[model samples]
Target: MKILGKITILLCGSLLLFFTSDFPDFGDANSPASLHLSPYFIEHTLEDTAVPNVVTSVLADYRGYDTMFETTVILTAGLACFLLLRIPKRAVKNRYYLHEPTGVTLRFEGDKYPQESDVFKRIDSSWVPYDIIINFTCRLLIHFIQIFALYVVAHGHHSPGGGFQGGVVLGASVILFAISGNLRAAIKRFGEKTAALFSATGVFIYAGTAALCMVLGENFIDYAALAPILGSDRIMARSHGIFIVEIGVAVAVMAVMIWIYYNLSSAGKQDEGL
Candidate 1:
């Protein structure tokens, strides 16, 4: 079986290499994408979408479906992680906690303590207020990170930042909170259920905007149809539509990042982790 597997792998690899051998070299100026697609976007994006950032226009307007489905894909990945990594219950023989005053680690042997009470259930093994300097410093920076993330999302039409980048920044803020404090602290503020819900909500926002355009009697993702509703010209409507969908992307990406981190870092328990 092992020999057969190795042979199959080698055959597949050789076939893939053979198929791609004739493909254009990386960044070939004469390639189809560079000659046609890139030039078309660069020349017409501003006029068509009223978006100064060609990349943003291409992502949110020209190839809107690609991004919508990509958001769906991110949601699917988060759901898959939840299904595969989440463990409903866990057994333990020891418990640990951090003493806030002295920063001493506390350990309790055996498993005779409380289990069901909400307050006592998750009392053991917490890393919160562990360090005064690090905790305070991170707490202060979290607000700025989140603000910058929002700026990135909103300013995407004119600059390099956008939903994906902003969402990553926002998610990193929460992750920092989790690290500065504890997993339970993070969970208390932004639980797994909330993260999953927010993830779905973000995808829904993007898809819903597209559907709204279709229902408004235009082709799907045709933001020009939103001119009347947005009280703007067709081109400006397209730009506004891009902004709306970028918000959706930002929300989805942020929630999914936190959700995946919670599951993977805690080994599916969501009890305690770095």
Candidate 2:
């Protein structure tokens, strides 16, 4: 059976390779896509989608199905990482705490710890969290980065940014928070459950929008069908649909990035990250 499987795989690979040889070469002007598809999109993108950026129109309106699936792929990766790496978090027997008053850190074994003091705070590591520069810098700049990420998601249609880019920035901000302090602090601000929920919600927002178009008696991904709900003409509705989809992509990407980082950093234990 193994030998037969190997032979079948080899035959399939050869057949696929042979077919790929007939595909158009890179930047071939005479290629079918270049000759017909490119011209059509460049000429009609603005009129069709009412988006100034041709690339955004192509992605969010023209190839919305592909973008939706791409978002699904990120969710799948996060789920896969969770399933493969996630382990039940055990009750911590020992912990580290920092005394803010005197710049002191202490480790406690078992459940015994300092009786709730305002000066002492829980820390992921005994060594890293008390840095004067790194912590202050990250805490100060993280808000700006988050705000910029929002701008990217909201203003993607008019410029060189979009959901994917915005989501990456948002996710990176969280990751920077993790790296600046510790995974425990980052997780506290944004919990694991929240990340998972956001990832799923992002996908739902996108798929729901498509399904809505169908429910409204139009083609599955036809944004023009959203005219009634969006309170706009077909072209404007298309623009609105693109913005909605971009938001979904941004949400999913950001959540997935954070989720994967959390798992990998803590080896799925959600303990003190490296």
Candidate 3:
């Protein structure tokens, strides 16, 4: 039975690889991908959507339903991390060395000490307070990162950036803050409760704006109905709507990333533990 199972798995894998050979080559100028749908997006997206970045237009407008699901995937990952690793209210025993000798000449009952160096001295617990430095730096970086993330989200329509790229960057900054500072500090900046709220809020913003078009007797995401409120012509409304949704995506992604990192690193410690 085992032999038969292994053979079946190998055959299936080989068939998958064989079929994949028919897929488009990466970055081939003459490939069907480059010549067909992509060409239309590249040459005409700016004229149609009034967005200079064709990729952004494709993601936010032409193929926005896919983008919505991608954002949901991020949200799912964050929730999974939170559920699997959230800190329990009760405290658990922490297993870390309080004090141990460092030198070349120490071995007793299958224990060994590495050779001492000046570098080790600097990093020694007696000399440095890891918590304090990490907390301070993390606090400072969060503000700067938030501003930069907003800029990336806003400028996406005019340039090579967009919601997904900017959202990931924003998410990473929060993750960095979590790693450098600690779970508690990171949560203080944006708690899991707040993160969940913002995630829903982001989706609402995107869907609500699109729904506005439906209410105005147009297609779901037809931005032409927003021309009056957005202070632009029909063409420009699409760009404006895309920008709004990008902001929503940025908020959702940043919150979810921080939430995930906190749950992972802390390892379910209600109080600080290593």
Candidate 4:
């Protein structure tokens, strides 16, 4: 029965592949995607939305619904990690004994030290001390990185960036914080509670802005209605709305990435034996 199931699954997959072989080739100018939606979006989006980047327009306005789903995916991932890898209030540590191929052994007690062996000592102790100057430079670069991430989010309308790219950059800045200092320090700066709250707040900001549009008697994402408050024309209102959502995405992504790093680094510590 198992063999039959495997064979059936393989046959079905092959049939699907066979059918897909006739689909339009990627990046072909004559393909339906290139000729139809792409051209229309390219020619009209700039005039209608006042954004120079076609991809940004597609993501933020032309297909804003899809962007909403993408944001939801981030939220779902954060929730799953929170549920699966949550650290318990009380956890124990395990002791490990290190043994070398050569017959040397070292035992660690109560998470105090790593198992030590002669071979391990050579490898671990051989690490040259990092230079203070280099560490200082890296610490300084983190500030610049955060500033650049904000620029990316803010300037997304006129260029090839948006919430997703900007969010990744912001998330990477926190990873630098983790690498430069200890994980505990990174968490202290951006704790699990703060990360979770930021993520929720980001989504709320996006949704609430759209809701406000609805209350003003426009469609859920009709940025034209927001033009009065934003102090801009309809097209500029769209640009402003996209910028706001991009900020939300950056916040959520940065928080989630930090949260994931924290959980993964602390996983072994969570399962220690008493």
Candidate 5:
């Protein structure tokens, strides 16, 4: 099976390479992609959208529906993972307790735990010795990571990063917490329910903004129509609308990434995940 898969991949790659010879060379200025819309987007994006980053203007404004549906795609993927892997609630039949200093194990049935036993703190089923260095490092880094992620999302109009890139960085901080500490602790901070809600909410924000433009008597996804609601001129309103949808994209991507990670790492049980 493995050899067959390898051969199949090789054949597909070879076919793709053969086809590529008919296309223009890398960065060919006369290429169809460069000649068609790329030049227009590069020259006029800032003038039309009032955003310094041409890429952001093109993605969040010029191609607003595309961005909105991409966010939907991420949310759908998260939902699909949840549906495929999430285990239904059931009674836990076994429990294990570890005596910290003494290094002893106590087993019990039917969700038994150490109550009033100060010597044995209630630990995750997959708990390991707490590494002070790792825990403290993650604790310190998480705040900075999240702050930078927000900056990246907000400043994409002037920089090289945007919603999808920033969202992935933000999600990594949560995964880092799980790795350095425990899955339960990470989930406690951002639970499955909250993640699911946020994932849907993000896509809603994007679609809702576009739909609102239509309600205001403009074409669908016509951000210029939002000028009255946002109390800005048409050009500025389009810029602001791009930022708003970028925020939505960021939120949806972040939640979806975390949701997928939780389901996959825990094998759908969401307990003692790596």
Candidate 6:
């Protein structure tokens, strides 16, 4: 089966590469893609959407339904992993601790005693000696990573990045925490319930925004109709609406990535994980 899968992938990639030979040269002005809609999108994006970033305007406004469905696919994958693998009940055996003073390890049966003093630090079942460099460096970098991710999302209208890209970066920061520190710390910071809620809320914000336009007497996902609510002109309303939906996409994608990571890493046991 694995060999067959590899052959299939190779065949598909070969076919795609062969087809690419017939495609127009890069930046060819006479190409069909360049002639048909690309020109119009490039010329009118600023006027129509009031967003300088043509890619963002197209993805968040013109092609929003597709992006929504893509986000749904991500959410679905997370849910499927959770449903299939999440273990509600599991027996934990050994509890590991690190003795700070003597640099020795201690293991206790079942759970650790409640009255255990601060001499020992309770560690994950798979815990290693605390690496001062990795832990401290991650602590220092996590904040900057999150802030940069937010910047990418918010400034995508004028820049190259967008919600999907920004969300992936944000998710990577959390995953970095899991890698540099411990999965237990990551789970404690962003629990399963919170991640699920974030994923749902993001999709809701996007779908609800589209529905709102319908309620305002326009077609579904039409941002122009949001003018009244936003106290802006039709073009500006569309711009703001795009930003709003982009935010939703970012939130959903971020949560789904984290959720999938947690499930796959722990095999859904929700205990110590990579």
Give stretches of model 4 more than 4 Å off: 1-16, 94-134, 268-274
Which one is best on lDDT?
2
Q: Of models 2 and 4, which has the larger TM-score?
A: 2
User: Where's the lowest-lDDT run of ten residues in candidate 6?
Assistant: 108-117
Candidate 4, residues 102-158: lDDT per residue as tens digits? 545354445365534455431212223335775687699998998988888888888
Model 2: per-residue Cα lDDT over 1-274, one tens digit each: 9999999999999999999989999999999999999999999998998999999999988898999999999999999999999987655566788788997878898757885368987777535646779889999999999999999999988999999999999999999999988787799899999999999999999999999999999999899999999999999999999999999999999999999999998888887775
Off by over 4 Å in 3: 1-12, 91-128, 131-140
lDDT of 3 by residue, 13-82 (tens): 9999999999878898888878898878988887888988887888888887787777778788877887
**What is the number of backbone collisions in each predicted candidate, taken in the order shown?**
1, 0, 0, 0, 0, 0
User: Candidate 1, clashing residue pairs?
Assistant: 96-125
Which residue ranges in model 2 land beyond 4 Å of their true spot? 1-19, 91-94, 98-120
- Which residue pairs of candidate 5 clash? none
lDDT for position 237 in model 1? 98
Model 1 Cα displacement at 160 (Å)? Answer: 0.8
| lDDT leaderboard ranking | 2, 1, 6, 5, 4, 3
Model 3 clash pairs are none
Per-candidate Cα lDDT values, in order, are 0.89, 0.92, 0.71, 0.73, 0.87, 0.88
Clashing pairs in 4: none
Compose the digit string of candidate 6's lDDT tens values, residues 37-134.
Answer: 89899999999999999999989899889988888888898899999989853455666777879978788785444344688776877666568899
